[model samples]
Target: MSLVDFSSDAFIVAFFLYCFGFLFYGVAIIGRKFSNRNPDEHMHKWGRIAFITSVLGFIAHLTFFFTRWAGGGHIPTSNMYEFMTFLAMMVMLAFIVVYAIYRKPMLGFFTLPLTVIIVAFAAVFPQEVQPLIPPLQSIWLKVHVTTAALGEAFFAVGFAAGLMYLLRVVDFNSKEKSMRIQQRWVEFTLYVVVIIIAFIGSVFAFRGMGYEAHFIQETVEISSQGVESTTTDDVKYSMPPIVKPYNSQVQSMDSFLGMKEPLFETPSWMKGVDAARKLNTIVWSIINGTILYGLIRLVLRRRIGAAIHSVMDGVDPEDLDEISYRAIAIGYPIFTLGALIFAMIWAYIAWSRFWGWDPKEVWALITWLYYTAYLHLRLSRGWHGKKSAWIAVIGFVVVMFTLIGVNLVLVGLHSYAGV
Candidate 1:
């Protein structure tokens, strides 16, 4: 096979390995109670097995990265698919480092599943390698994207640990107002994760069935020379349309589940390229996510958070909190270097400006500032445990919005990254 083909195969192997690692980690955590052997010994043996599997998966993932780099003639991080896959690999790397330091099996229980979800999510985007755009043709593209994603991967690990800390410590059965509020927010966070999984499922299901719809969207632009120009472009969807593009005509649409046409037109305010498609995807995610959540709730007859919290009974909240803090602390400076310094250097070379108020740039700044405040509150205000964990969790939301939401909802210099 060609190196690119081999890389693709290696990526598939890595994905399965990660999934197996997650399952093994789950067994290490959950099977201990059921095993005939001593609990500590059982966990130790399974955790060791899981760790080895994860390390092998990381090696396979690295193989994929290097082979793809060699074959594709550029780093495999120029698009959403490549970037997300790379981020997943980096998360595994970060997890490995933290796991070695802490030797906590429960950490793998949380982190491996996250790495699996990320790798799966990355599959939702197109995987075909394309030539880098003119703006992305600099060496800084490699430096900036790789470093930024690596930093974000550490934040992802912190998020997993922080979330686990919350689960371990939160009073899921409490009737007190404060605890109830925390319970609801934790459930909401889990629902958001479910939504992401639902999105990946929905995309793959439709893609497998070869579902498609087409539209021709028109745009009118006024130039600096006082000239008005009109353009029309073709937009395609792999999933059924819940909303059509603004000011667009349907070219062809495949009927889905007896729905032949879009239920609504996109708002005029959402003028970003393929904004309607993105909105449709979001709508489907919520719909499918809610249904899946309902099914899980039905099976357990308890809140999802409560169900998860049961498995977290013996895990120390303090250790999780410390891991979360340390991971973020390590990531913050790297993020500053990658997202700000290197980005500015690249921006100057590309746009002749170090700072532009583009939506992406603005959100990146907002993310940096939010995390800066997190560190300040953590150090200066003495936030720890729940408060610190909450910030770590929320900070990841900020990081994700900076990475994804800006691309989907706003048009800017970084729009070429795709949805």
Candidate 2:
């Protein structure tokens, strides 16, 4: 077998192992409440195990990607499967580096499950091999997308960290209220993770059980007012044997006609429009995440951790304000350089245009504007502390929209992402 075939099989096994690890980790987390367990309880022993397993998983993930690239004779990020895999891998690697510096294993608690999620979603997309189209033959495809994805991955880390910070800072006077908060977070997390896993997992599990996407084409007759319109028959549309992610590179006219008929035999009119495959990558981002997280704080109704609360209880609000200011000072410029300048330069090289008002591009502009306003609010109007942190959090929502929702929902020239 080719190296890629071997690698694909290996990656599949690695994915299974990763899923098992997550189950154990989740059990361990819940077990903490029951058995008075701490993630760092064994300190050295559990940490070592976590590190080894994570590193091994990361290596196998990289091997799958590199092997695929070797077989294809190009970058592996040519489709949604490849791109999602790349992004998730980048996030995991970033988490490892951050954990090394921060010495915080809690971050892994969030990152690992999320990595599984993106990988699971990727499994739903088509994985069949296809040659690269002419437009994808540019050096910047590697440069622009890679750096941008890494940058987004960094911000994702920041978002997760920031959420943890929020949770740590929050508290409730009543145990009842606190329990409610914890339960809510757990339920939301479960909803998201389960839905994605079930969607993709079912597809793979059934396929493994010898089921497949069956595509067949046939014509039907329609009679209107006794005028029979016999659709020229003998063309059967069936799903691809293996469902792969949608490829925007396919000529739409030819691509549409190639789809298998609706499994339930819906009328042709019921077939959905194939504009941009998915645009949710950018849409869910604008739903006021800062407000949501902030509102949670309001409901919690008291300071959370005694240690953190005590540390903040006496410090001048201005000092805390300055710390937040410094974080924004460091993050804003880097975000601009990564999301806007790098992206535009890459787009110009690849698409022959600096900007096309693609939904993803537009959301990136929205993110920039959000942060710009944040800086202005901070420096000029003296916004700081709770307000400033709130803005920083909001900025992340914009960034997420730019990074994920756009690719998932919005359709445009940047549909390469939806692939």
lDDT per model vs. reference: 0.91, 0.57
Candidate 2 lDDT over residue span 128-217, tens digit each: 666777667777677666766665565556555544444344442336876567545533543343444554544565446552232223
lDDT of 2: 0.57
* Cα TM-score of candidate 1: 0.96
Off by over 4 Å in 1: 220-230
Tens-place lDDT per residue, model 1, 16-36, is 999899899999999988999
What is residue 125's positional error in candidate 1, in angstroms?
Answer: 1.5
Distance from true location, Cα of 315 in model 1, Å:
1.1
Best by TM-score: 1
Query: What are the per-model numbers of colliding residue pairs?
Result: 0, 34
lDDT of 2 at 56: 79
